[model samples]
Target: MAPRPRFSSVPHHALAALRQRPAVATAVFATGLLAATAVVNRQLARKAERENPPMGRFIHVHGVRLHYVERGEGRPLVLLHGNGTMIQDLQSSNLIDLAAERFRVIAFDRPGFGHSARPRGRIWGPNEQADLFKEALDKMDIDRTVVLGHSWAASIAAAMALRHRASVEALVLASGYYFPTYRPDLAAPSIPAIPVLGDVISNTISPILARLMWPGLMRKLFGPKPVPEKFAAFPVEMALRPSQLHASAEEAAMMVPMAVAASKTYSEITVPTVILAGEDDRLIDVEQSVRLHRVIRNSRLRRIAGAGHMIQQTEAAILMAAIDEAASISAGGGSDPRDVMTTNG
Candidate 1:
């Protein structure tokens, strides 16, 4: 009773079995590698075009494919949308419809966000994305132009101005995010390597956490503080569609560091610039734009009341006014933000 059952002796064969488990070890290692590889591929597949603007063709640059719309023939005005949304969101925005009349409004899907392909193993932060745009413009023979960056695009615009100051004529940063401190609410999408186990889980299930706690995620980015019916007429649903999910996820992941890096260069910005923000912006703090306005020498800040993060979506008229104001102010024609610039008039 005290002795109980004696323990069985360790088997040499069991030790041998453990040593011979290379197949099992290889399988396990392969599983992890495969998981990582699939994720890498989805990130790589960013080059595939899912949503094409009914207007523009796809351009390939350094293994990346970008979707952009080139409308009008005057001075080039390149438009960049924020994270999660692409050129379509900007196209849906009045910012485009309003600005295209006077300037050549060219809007593009940043790599990993829109119809453009995603390049893996690298951060497509503002610097890289900005560099990509300069290359694209060079390819298009656009030596000088205006660049308007919205949301995260603002980071890219800042980078563009910093890197190639002379190439860009004027910079209009709307709801820009080149702040040093990241908001606490920012969430990163952990994209998986495959359809179900990887991207599916990331694109679908986990967002439920946000949808449940903060239903605002389900809404459109602009306000009256709720999702706009026109933008999110359908829900966020699934982000798997390449144009929506991967690009947005990468942008989200890259936000904080990119913003911090770009913030340092503001005071150095020499371009005639304008900082546009919503007084009630929920996505990024208004101070970000305000500070940017204060730091840049020639930059001015325009804050629209009762507007949310989607200033372009919510306060399009005001944003257009600001853009026209920037152009007028730079040209020494008008100091007022409301100066009209209609070619017909």
Candidate 2:
């Protein structure tokens, strides 16, 4: 008989077994891909950190280190950024510098968003974040300051106003997401931020997918208006790092439930409130700001025309004016007549 052909030094039995159990082959391939992805992700993360170092100082609050940047020297003004951002979001837009010229501007990276730490096994909703920030401000001897929160931070500002009323003199809520609205898109990250496997996915494939999706999502966020020129230079890669991505997912997941609970307590905020919304805000409805203005008895609402969700960057002049009005009202001075302009889109 002719010599039998040997299969590339492999046993026919093993080859047949692999073919019989296709799932085993798939699992092996998936494991290799995951390992490779993890190695590449680690290298990229290290490179990003080396390129973009921390831009602020750190202070320990309840044994958790918080990062913040302060400027100017006048009435205290605390700036809290939205989800997926750091203090640089305010700094790059020159909001901190502009406010700093007249007020002691303190901009913070809310726990887990930047260099700040979010301890494991902790659920940090708006209330939890408010309490943590309150402790940090207390350590810094900061009290009775105007708190400005953009987007998701808006809810945190409201929580601070409600829980720590004595410390929050005024609130400037820009592009605030109030009144729990069903947003299926926003709910995407909620599942992946759970425990165990969720943690694994967030640290692995989540950041990778986020990095890939950022460009399109950012375009939508600044739609009907161009993204600020300075934003091009923002360290987005660093924000997309694994830890930050996980924190962002957690925050996004918690937003709706937190807003639902906090919306009921809007009337409790007695501080002078300034609700700002861009007429073209595509992220959160501008009507939310209108509702907020109605609920907070002392609120002044400003609807900016031709502006997008990022009013702090797009309509800085108007936003700054609103901040000034809020500060004045908090100081027992009446609201600015210019601030009560009619809503126009």
Per-prediction TM-score: 0.74, 0.92
List candidate 2 segments past 4 Å from native: 1-17, 333-345
Off by over 4 Å in 1: 1-55, 187-200, 203-215, 218-220, 232-243, 333-345
- Model 2 vs. true fold: TM: 0.92
C-alpha RMSD of each candidate structure in angstroms = 9.1, 3.6
Candidate 1 clashes between residue pairs 3 or more apart in a chain or in different chains: 39-193, 46-117, 46-118, 47-117, 47-118, 112-247, 192-198, 220-227
Q: Give me the displacement of residue 311 in model 1, in angstroms.
A: 0.9
Give the alpha carbon lDDT tens digit for every residue of 1-345 in model 1: 487787665776655665799787677777776667546545533433333323577887777888888786677889888776766676665667788888888899777655567876776778888888998898988988888888878888888999988788788898877776745555545353333554555443444443464455534356555655556522233233533565566666667777666767778887778787777776688788767766787777777777778877766777777677666665673333332121110
lDDT of 2 by residue, 1-345 (tens): 999886674677777887899999788779888778777877887788789788879999887889999899999999999998888888888898889889999899888877788887788889989999999899889877899999999999999999998899899999999998888987677656877777777667987888788888887788788887988767887787777888888888888888889889999888889999988888888899988888888888888877779888777777788788899887875544323554443
Best by lDDT: 2
The model with the greatest TM-score is 2
Model 2, position 267, has a per-residue lDDT of: 92
